[model samples]
Target: MTGEDIYFAGVGDVHGEMYEMLGLLKKWESRLSFVLQVGDFEPHRHEADLQTMDAPGKYRKLGSFAHFYNGSAVFPYPVWFIGGNHEPYGFLDRIANNTEIATNCYYLGRVGTVELAGLKIVGLSGIYKEHLFEKRPPIEEIDRHSNADYIGFTENEVLQGLEFQRADILLLHEWPRGLMTPDNRLDVIDPEMVGNEYARMLVDSLKPRLVLCGHMHRYFCHQIVWPDDTITRVCCLAHTRSGSNAVEIFRLSGNRSIESLRSLDER
Candidate 1:
């Protein structure tokens, strides 16, 4: 654990499948120092009343992560994640700003940077919504409805993100725009389903060593060369709830910089 190399695991959307996710991680636990999920971690338990609320099916509250949140189950390794469109905002907001949900599990807020296992990790929860980003709305306004909160972010949150300069890894629920195929004629992702433009702008500015994201439910990887001649590895993982071998590993040098990237194919 005190060497020039550190090993960690990264995954895509959990969508409240904690047990299923943990089952897969079990094999890698001995080698991995920690685990990180991209989004849709669903860190709350639904009350009886909320479960019966008159909201639409999608708006209905579900507490899949409640077991972990309430100490019914414990994550064997250090677990970290951001919020997604499907999480319980009420519960997450209560413990905002990297609060520990369990002994080894923590929530990375709307926008934040943390040092873990000698690596700098930055996280931003939720995808970029046009109404919130351009209108500069407040979280208070979005809090009026349960679904609105899932859209995520206030003007302040975006502004706070601008302050983050560099990180060893950046985690977000959305993908950066303009990621293309090897031929570069068209986008590797859906044009209409592109992610945060501001996030892409930050990638240009911060130039982190690694950027991991979810929400697309598919896997893609690209090597981005920044203006400073530094390289950033961007990867989108498959939904861990269904995707086989959901965990991806990365190695870091003693200087706290990434040395190599590993994916399911490599295993």
Candidate 2:
């Protein structure tokens, strides 16, 4: 990599294991420009905050977010993330979109766009649910609703995401449809139940060079070639429990095109 080359890390679903996630990325922290995490990060500040997350009681440990929140542990690099099905909605709902939730940490909100290292990055948080697709109650009413109420991406959010003309990288919590073919089918995930149509539409419309996602807790890579020969690379990552498979690194040139990409587990 040259001085003009930008290196960054993309992390999979954290599921509240902040300490483990940080440890996994420690080796590359000094070289990375930033870290982008796909959702289910679960940055809860306290027990009350954990209650607002949509997860089973057994899976709801507070993890390590509170240490970061209380200034005990600082993030090694700038971390940007979208929300997943599992998140602290009670606390995040109180803040505005793209707001910094902690020092050097930012939440990309329901639909967000940001420019980084000369690349246009867009993110759409949460999974798609047909019943909740068109529903978005006022933010003020978020507290009154159950934790499950805020887990899905609304139709309005998807429409808002479509406004971006193009993107160098698109962040999503779930995989897009059409990624699974007979050659790449995994016994762990059903071919028909793996991805969502809205996400596929976003990829086809925005035509981003790269798409990063988590939620399914499995690592897979696929490429979509448009009629014009433009290619979009999609990488689905596993959860933190899978160790190195949950993280991937990318090196981009000054021109904002990917020069090299590899998963931590490659070695």
Candidate 3:
């Protein structure tokens, strides 16, 4: 069976840019079924700032977004958001949405699964801060450390708490470069071994068919070979520096591709 065509207007780290993006999305609702974003809604909260602050109430704009996002006053599609390290809460898995936007925004926190048109979608969000960056020093020092603990904690939460041991579609925020990819090659990486270790564990253990992530936003969309001849399509979308992006689309008729899908983004 051919894969269905599902439109996903996904973007992240827009922070103050949500209003502009939201307007554009309204015009393109006819062609999309859902949307996805990887985190960093607050452009101000860099990795260094997250560890130092105890209560990031300053970034309450997200709460406002949640209020509107969960409401039907304005929106045309469902939004699937994974917690970025910038997300100030713990286990962001709760989801509330309205039908006017046809939007069902769900944040899986660490790990989750979604079924659309007979396809399975799984995800894990938020940073593994407890293990990676519990203590905050200076801004300079925070950068020196790695977000592996944060990544690992998220993974642990998904695997241990959610019971998503075997996912057909896995979503993670980090990419580990040290483990053997689904293609059986050593996935070379930099920074903390734990970050690589954590992601690699999913790649090695879960062996999903597709994995979408958005942490090292350098524009990544490729395939990895895992054990048992399984291939994992890992995608890292580049957030719009100006506007929104056409990141997701679904067609039950199997007419899915970046080329044929409608584009309403005005970025």
Candidate 4:
């Protein structure tokens, strides 16, 4: 790691595609850094509001709702995740709102920080209320496992409270702006404009050198249009090509400059 503070590895939209994580882990796991999965762990079930019983007269609570490597492989570093619309609210939302569950692995609600390789990592689940429009469908209406639309934080709410400038990296579930695609499939019609509006807001204002996100599924990368002098690089990474076999390794250090920064953006 250069004078650059730390290194970050990220992935998004695993739609139950656990196999894709191995290739990346195989190559980069030995480095001194951290790993982050933005959201969409798949195989998730929302049992919170689904009091309705299944065939056997037993009510089905959310199942297949936890975040995993999917491939069931162990990552070399501490693996952390943000909330996706697919996570179990009975598990995640409760943890975010309840102070007691703050540190529990099962529920790493909204924003939490991890320090490694001399970097501070801050994270937020994808299913925040602001990302879900009010006129948009209810949480249960859109996805099966989540109880309500992300009724928790707005983009400003998240930005105002957090100490972004101090953190080395930020992990989120959706894109900020110019990053979202106009033709997302889940809408079934008009675009929902989720992260397109503000993921950019934090990146431009906070100026963290790196931001890792999911939700768009396609590959993406961008530099912060406006940034602080100390935080010179900005990147929006692309998702792995396929869940079974895809990976990207990113390197950073204080010595980082224009030459190597461009190299990281290559396909």
Give the winner by lDDT. Answer: 2
The C-alpha TM-scores of every prediction are 0.85, 0.95, 0.61, 0.62
- Overall local distance difference test of candidate 2: 0.87
Deviation (Å) of 53 in candidate 1: 12
lDDT of 2 by residue, 126-168 (tens): 9987777989566567678777888899988899999987888
Task: Report residue 151 deviation for candidate 4 (angstroms).
Answer: 7.6
lDDT of candidate model 3 versus the reference: 0.48
Which residue pairs show collisions in model 2?
none
Cα lDDT tens digits for candidate 1, 92-192: 65566888877788889878878988677888888787676655334344445545534555556766766777777888788887676546424444564
lDDT of 1 at 45: 61
The lDDT values for all models are 0.72, 0.87, 0.48, 0.49
Instruction: List model 3 lDDT by residue over 140-182, tens digit each.
Output: 4434544332333443454552455666556666554543334
lDDT of 4 by residue, 1-267 (tens): 345555556666554444455454555556636556776543343333333211122423233323331333334565566666544444444444213221222333566666556556666665445445333333344346334445334554466425555555666776665543444333434334546555555665555667777666655555444423454243444455554222345665566432222355643
Error of 1 at 4 (Å): 3.9
User: Which regions of candidate 4 are displaced past 4 Å?
Assistant: 1-7, 42-73, 96-108, 127-148, 155-165, 179-194, 225-234, 237-246, 254-267
TM-score-better candidate, 1 vs 4: 1
- Cα displacement (angstroms), candidate 3, residue 220, comes to 1.4
